[model samples]
Target: MTRVPAYFDAFLTAVAGGAEIDHVHLGHWDAPGAIGPARARAGFAQAQDRLSAALIAWLDLARGHLVLDVGCGFGGSLRTIRTCHPGVEVIGLNLDPRQLAVGFRRDRRRRNATWIAADACRLPFAGGMFDRLLCVEAAFHFASRRDFFAEAHRVLARDGVLVLSDIVLTRPPLPEEEVALLADGLEAAFGPWPDKWASLDAIGRDAEAAGFTLLVTDATANTEPSFHTIAPGRSDRPTSGDVLRELHRLGCLHYLYLRLDKR
Candidate 1:
């Protein structure tokens, strides 16, 4: 069994209390309200799946290549990888077994698809276990981004690539007071925060320290559509969404994409 830390295991067990998670929107929704709720949800998921596919295309994969997707919530990207790259064996890893349990259809499990419930910072597999590592909008949740980067470096094959999307602070550094407001915005927009802003240079430094060389870096502010989504029951204070939008308008936040190769 994977030895989850005592406190974190307790926390995750309590959170799992026989339940599921997340409905707020966060992506480039070209058509926000053009359809019904069910259709819209399906479209958003498909878009995210396509985004995953786009990221994986950079790998130039070959037959029988092994891939690991960290924090593979609901296995959306897993489905895309299996369909898009035939003969590529892939693992969908998430910390919560409940997520892995419900991520697939009754007949969806395949010979090449393996799902593991384990922490990102402590991969349970052997060294040089994966050819490509994909993490989409999930790295920020790790207890330490630097720790996860080091873990990623350790598990990836010598020539392997790590492609991930994350939220980071905008350069030209905003006022120190803006940090709290941005945190509130993130809470309003995504309901998750690492309790501190991660700047672009900070991420690069962490990855460099992990024995990896940065290959590609890009930032996108294409989250305006997500801000328009309705997440209710916060009438008491300014919605975190509002704060997020204003800060975004001020160029204080960005959606970052990074591709790093193991040194």
Candidate 2:
């Protein structure tokens, strides 16, 4: 048997280890009562709500169009988009069969949505086939950010739009210790963080290189505190509980939302 790619292996491990992938793709882990302890459940729920809202706001999806959701985890974003844009056709692509299975089961009643197991670097669709492309929280996992952008450009119509929300390192951590701390926090939460997360400047550069015009970019740090506070209320435990406190202390979370138009 062939060995699995290291990044994929790490992704599976992180998901299995109770690191919720909700930020990247939406789907609740199906556990007996809940996936994580009560405290963790609260934090996870809060993050999910905020991330989901940001994705919808950024995409501003329209009806009667073809949309492709790359690295769609558990299909949460796809479902949300479809519900919001009733006449739209949504295709969710993911590499993990298990994740796709959960998404399929959850959204079985929605006929306008479809799911496929495929690589992000090489989507199995014709050029200019889609009107909109949305990727939430999963761009860092692509082996080549450049290739990912190129594929997005190729698959999108000339006037199409691409919305992406992902975790990005704001500035290079100065001290070596700070760098290590940041890296550790990310790895603990995300399995393995990407070597170079696209900064604001980098995002603009890449979009231009990929034949897209940058439209909007927003940092979500200020809003994060409010959402984190709200998340615990959805859980069975108190908001100040252990797991919530831990996730907060590590500064293990941050997000950026961007909108681009294909040229």
Candidate 3:
């Protein structure tokens, strides 16, 4: 097994409690019954549910379909998928053993969902093993998104679909200071990232080079709610939302919804 990164170990240590985050990703307020001011006021759990539902809708899952949730933090999306599509088989792959242990404990009742501690860069499965792949707000931390994409393409069947929601660079090169701030801010809040940020065009190129055809892209404005709903006394570290907001103001970043199919 590939060794886990030290900074990531530190991150898990910082947020050691189980189920502390109902959802770590910024949610889709455009989801049904979650739109407008009402969604903005909804609690963290509700917003996360909406976001999971929206991403799941893109998969078009079928009975007996095999799904892989890469970087499946705490298995929230895994549970959502398994509960919604009980006939589907779901696997959650994460680097943190603590997270996998906690997720397995929480998911014991859902026989269709399971968790594993594995690196995304080097998936330990056979080619054409999965029917669908989902990565929620966690691709940015991969050792190499390009490598992960290639692995996903290799492991997915010809008809498989890849759905990912993540923070992507939306504009031109960032100022050096801004880049440093973004990197430092993220390390302070969550953990280390290999490249920190990649441009949308670069990501698309990587996906195409990995043999995928980009099908859909949704750039959303519902970025601020996740920060707004931070529970009381969660952490004293600088808020990731503030850093992301600054990047957004500079036209340097965005949270994007991407759907791609193996070609």
Candidate 4:
């Protein structure tokens, strides 16, 4: 078994305790009906709707297909996918044992879904094992994007699709102070962001380098509504009271939804 990174283990532990993996997103962001302490349920409803929209936009899921959910947290997305596409076979994979435990505990009776504790960089399946791969909110933990992409490509069947959503730095920080601030924020939230996050252009280049044909890349900023609904007390700016602000300031977020076809 590949040794899990200490930071990732810590992140899983934190999330299991109701802490958001990203420091900026509120603990209650994933709550079903309301953002923290907010009386408005519409925001929560909209948040769920927007997430469903984003997931569908990214996945293009089909029936009777084998789909892998990489970095699936608590199996919520896996359960949702199975519910949405009843004919699809969905498997959730996570490197964090604690997170997987949570998923399994919550979904042990769901026959259409399976949870696997596995490393993204070195998947345990045979080559061409899956028809589609989906990753949300976890690609940044990969130490080597090239290796991660290569592994995904190796396990994917020819012409299989890969859909991923993650945080990307739009512009390189200009000053040393800015860079340090970003690093510190990341460390506080999870551990360390990957050393080589590319610009949007670079993301495409790297996909090509890993032998994938890029199909789509979109942002969630416009699609996702304000955090006010999900995390009522959250501020737009980083302050002690605003978790979302801290996440944004730390450069911990900026959505990138990408689709690629394996060659």
The candidate that achieves the highest lDDT relative to the unseen native structure: 3
Model 2 clash pairs?
Answer: 46-231
- The TM-score values for the models, in the order shown, are 0.75, 0.71, 0.83, 0.75
- Candidate 4's error at 39, in angstroms? 8.9
Ranking by TM-score: 3, 1, 4, 2
Model 4: runs farther than 4 Å from truth? 1-49, 171-174, 223-253
The root-mean-square deviation over C-alpha atoms between each candidate and the true structure, in angstroms, is 5.6, 7.5, 3.9, 5.5
Error of 4 at 13 (Å): 7.8
Better of 2 and 4 by lDDT: 2
Model 1 vs. true fold: TM: 0.75
Candidate lDDT scores, in order, read: 0.68, 0.66, 0.75, 0.65
Per-residue lDDT tens digits of candidate 1, residues 227-262?
444332256865545665556667766876689888
Question: Which residue pairs collide in model 1, if any?
Answer: none
- Regarding TM-score, does 1 or 3 come out ahead? 3
TM-score of 2: 0.71
Model 3 C-alpha lDDT per residue in residues 60-91, reported as the tens digit of each score: 99999999999887788998888889899999
Q: Give the TM-score (vs. native) of candidate 4.
A: 0.75
Per-residue lDDT tens digits for candidate 4, residues 1-263, read 54444545555667668863322121223333333335334454445445544655566777778888887866766777777788899888987777777777777457878889888888889999888888776777777667788888989987888887766655444577865765665556554456534666677787899899987554534323344443345336443224334444555446666788888
Q: What global local distance difference test value does model 3 have?
A: 0.75
Give the Å error, residue 45, model 1.
4.1
